[model samples]
Target chain A: MRMPVVRTIIGVLSLVSVIVTVILGLFITPPDVVQGNLARLLYVHPPVAWVAYLAYGVTSLASGLYLWKPTRSMRWDQIAASSAEVGVVFTALTLVTGSIWGRPAWGVWWTWDARLTTTAILLVLYLGYLALRRVQVSREKRAKRSAIAALIAFIDVPIVHESVNWWRTLHQGATVASIGTNSKIHGIMAWTLLLGFIAFTLVYVWMVILRYEVTVTEDAIEALNISAWTLERENEIGSLSDEIAGLLSDNKDRTGTSSSKVR
Target chain B: MISESIAVAIKDLRVERRSKVGLNQVLPFSLVVVLLFGFSLNTQSRVLTTIAPGLFWVAITFSSLYLISRTMRLERENGALDGLFLLGISSVSIFIGKLLALLLTIFVLEVIQIAAVVILFSVHFESIALICISTILATVGIGTVGLIYGSLASDDRLGESLVPLLVLPILAPIIIAATNCWSDALGNHGGLGDPWLVLLTVFAIVFLTVGVSSFGAILED
Candidate 1:
């Protein structure tokens, strides 16, 4: 009951924010003298990259938590899955938009610059992580395994960002992040980017919560099925039912005892 | 405990010796890579000489992935890994022993590879000892992390393909550091400065510790 209300609020708010940002992104932001309309990608591209990093960062933190204590709490896995899903989506978008930017600016769709190649590799690594999660049979195992992958995946992020400085590559080095702002015109465009960041962040948090709710419901169904199976077995075997129940309960406790916190 | 580590490693070696499956597979694949490079490039000595070092290192990195996966998958499939788990040997010893064996295997293949490259491309080596040290240190780093990923992937079904994806990111530092050192040595530049070597050594040690410490957790099924 509470879920539907929360869902409704999040759905409406996220839609409104998306619409607002898109409008601002399309018309309000000024075009670059160098890139013209093509430069409009900046609003979408940077925010999406930022969001992707934020999502992976969330995965890394959640993974650490899960490792510290493995728990049935849907929250930790929810955080991990939500963040990874969003990260993959935005990473895909970043790659496409980056290619678009490349075609116009560099006159090539792809270049094997260390940055571009490393980013591509990073994307492949995460995709592999996601695939591993899908193929694993059990939820507990999936979380533990993917958590390890997430921690490992993070090794690439700093490297990807630093690839330009580390090696000679065709890709350009840090622009917005470079020391001292390159932009002289920091008015409406800057404001729009800030708004875009906020909008994406709100969407991320709302989506994470929504995904958590779904996972919780699924877990409950699984739990209920296990309980029903035990009850049915008990009825079939008269007096030994209690003993079986005790065994099942003990098994549950042992499995659940190790680590259970979601946050 | 040390003997236990040897036992595990020897078990792997004996299997490989009898089967020769890993050696056969990697040898042909590497040979194909060589042929592809030969046909693709012109027969200019200057060009071949320039590209030989990079080519050799790339081949090493790529082939190591396949070899490590073969070794790891054998343990995974036979449930031997679980059997070894029951042995109660320290994880560090297992890591070191495996690292040593992997280093030796890769070094042997690399020697054959370097010979081929030298004959084909006419490149020269000024200091074999320095190059050997750099190669060993680089292999140590690669093997340490490779052991971790190999162990993790052993738990999963994907096996060999999973390793490159899991590792390429982690391998970036070592690759960059080692390649730079190798190029410096080959180019008649001064000794790979102490600082860089120290960094490589430190990185290898840290990863070896991590691989050793985490093996138990990952093996817990």
Candidate 2:
């Protein structure tokens, strides 16, 4: 019931999408009319942000599951941890690709614009969540504590989304959905970006599943190893003490015989 | 429960009074922040007038962060929060009482910080009551969420990084409103137009309700 066929299909599809996206990402999408090659960073940046949001959604689902069930089961905990890890990676990629794009587009590597600042803060929050998990001793405690943190952090996501709209800041509002905007992205660029978004999402899902499986297997292995070692130690303690006591008894019997002979 | 809430708040105040830890931590940082702004801008009065609200709020935000983090740490580190939970008082009352105490601390800090700024930047206070009320509305929102997230972040060792993440995004609306209100107050542009106060008041209510209801979940194992 491991569903090897399903995993295989997913793996193959993931690879095919990655290959197609990379091809489109590299050659097919036209460069920015204004920023030139630097705008190419958008090919990665938007998809990365998309994956970050996807990961946060996963975190929320896992959090709700944890709160509702309250089980010792590692499944929900593993999913939460893996989603956070993947989210952190995506957030980092967004920031890096954003700065790279900024270098050419904004004439600086960084800007204190609302979008950039909120995005950076989101990245930091998840990074902190991951770091916090490392310091806790018990898995249950870590997961519960992090579940609460994740919930709080999730609340901030909508706020971050609205920061640009709420505040008068340097960051421009929604790029694609803005009304009366004639930026008219070429068909090729839109298709390629959409493909890249799908591809990145597939990668994010794969990583989470793989990471969760690793955690489950690791826990199982640890439990197995612990039982095995305890069994060995129990057997050693059983036979070694008996052997020593038996030797003493045999010596005492021989001493009794010697005493009888002496008598 | 009300008595217990006061006890908790007074316990915090007594310790802070004795050590001056929270007070001292905020005053200097806020002063230096305002002074740094002065040095950077020098004599750009127009720019100063324009950005003063933001600078004032930024100073207020960072200073309140310091106070909230310190107060939460005192409870968390000593396991006082757990003790309070065991006493079977309403979490909402605990939240309100702690918020009351924290607002006092934040208000005093803001007053002193803004005083320093007013001295340095020559800010004209056309309506002190308006600034104070707007600040109270804004800080109520900030502290409500701040205490919730402050307590949330206390469990994690990443308090330093976590507090701001849990705060600034929530702080956005209040900061915007207060910034608009303050600049309007200073420019004699006629009192923040009731709409902004209405918005701040609504935001404060929402955060308070959310903070009080969800806080117990934050403390759960």
Candidate 3:
């Protein structure tokens, strides 16, 4: 399962696919009839957002499995942490790209549109999840606490979306701002988008594998360091005890008395 | 279980009574926020009334942050939380107990806030019944979610900051729904008709279930 060769192959393939995707999406694809070249951002933005969502979904699912009694393991915790880190990165990218795309389309750098606002909140929620993991605690305690937090956050997402949507409707009242998706997307644009999705998903897979490997290695190093420190402490204690015994013998010899009486 | 829950709630209320932290500190902080909002806006009475719903909820939200930290601090100090575990009481009871106590405390805070808003801003609520229902549901929702995050962050070094970060984003729906419900009750936009209240109710139910079910796991050391 820890196939570095396979991971490298996937990583290289992802790079190639992404490069091809960028070229096809930006240069080769025909411009949209309405939004001009800005429509090309559609190729990059949605896939990245999709990957962010996918990553968070995986994180929450792994966390839930870890919390369940029958399936609990350190592996699930590792998966949850690594996936969430990747998810956070992609979410940040999603916001940046979405803002860039929005500025020209919406005539504003940021709008309180439902999807955009919810995504911003999503970023904060997972960022908080990452911060929760950094709190110093026992592994089981950290995992257990974060698993529940993750589940709660996941459950809140749809509700967050719903409330934001309702609030947007009440305030804005039918303001038309295209948030990436449209029913009219077809032909080469659709193909490019599909490629974008595939390529980005591959990138996600590659990143998660490498990140998980790094986590496992780091855990091993920490374990080894702890054991080595304990061994060194034991050796120091052994030598100190010998020195004390020697001192006691010297006292006995000098005093010409039983050591038992001193004890 | 009910007795245990009530006992824990009483213990928390008794502790709060002795400490007076909520009464003296948090309540005054909220009133100050209300006053600060008025000063910052420096607008007409109508404008103050217009934004009163948002101001009231924002004040409640911030003060709830204070309330949760104080309540959790009571458990953290002197290993009192460990004492609870040692007593072999169920974590569900502990959760409900703390939740009930928080709910009551927040209710009182909201009441004072409502009074302040009505007095200082000269605002009149057209529908007291709807306002009461929305306030009760929203308070329960906030209390439930607040306690969950409070327990989650209680042991962290950066807990005070982290709890608000975790709680606020999740509480966004409650804040929105409650604000809209308040607007409706105040006849701001001729009453949007029951959906906002339903949303608030749903939020309360979801978090209540989540808190009750997961409290044991989160409280495990």
TM-scores, each model vs. reference: 0.81, 0.78, 0.93
Model 3 ranges with Cα > 4 A deviation: A169-183, A257-263, B188-193
What is the model-wide C-alpha lDDT for candidate 2? 0.76
Give lDDT tens digits, candidate 1, residues A1-263: 68778777877787787788889779877788878888777777777777877888898888778877655454777678777877787778778889998898999988878767666766777877776666544677667777777876675456444543355577665555632465643677777766777777777777777777777788799789989999988787975877889999999987787556432
Model 1, B55-83: lDDT tens per residue? 77777788888878876777777687667
lDDT at A80 for candidate 3?
92
1 or 3, greater by lDDT: 3
Looking at model 2, residue A33 earns an lDDT score of: 81
Candidate numbers, best TM-score first, in rank order: 3, 1, 2
- What DockQ, between 0 and 1, does each candidate earn? 0.34, 0.21, 0.82
Model 1 error, position B49 (Å): 2.7
Candidate 3: which pairs clash? none
Question: How would the candidate models be sorted by DockQ, starting from the highest?
Answer: 3, 1, 2
In terms of TM-score, which candidate is strongest? 3
Per-model TM-score of chain B: 0.90, 0.92, 0.96
Better of 1 and 2 by lDDT: 2
Model 2 regions lying over 4 Å from their true place: A1-9, A28-43, A69-74, A102-114, A169-189, A217-263, B1-3, B39-50, B127-129, B155-177, B190-199
Error at B170, model 3, angstroms: 0.9
Write the residue-wise lDDT of candidate 3 on A1-263 in tens digits.
55799899999999999999999998999998999999999899889989999999999999999988999999999999999999999999999998898889888878888988889999999999999888877778888988898999999999999999988832233211232455577768888888998999999999998999998898889789989999999999999999999999898787776655687
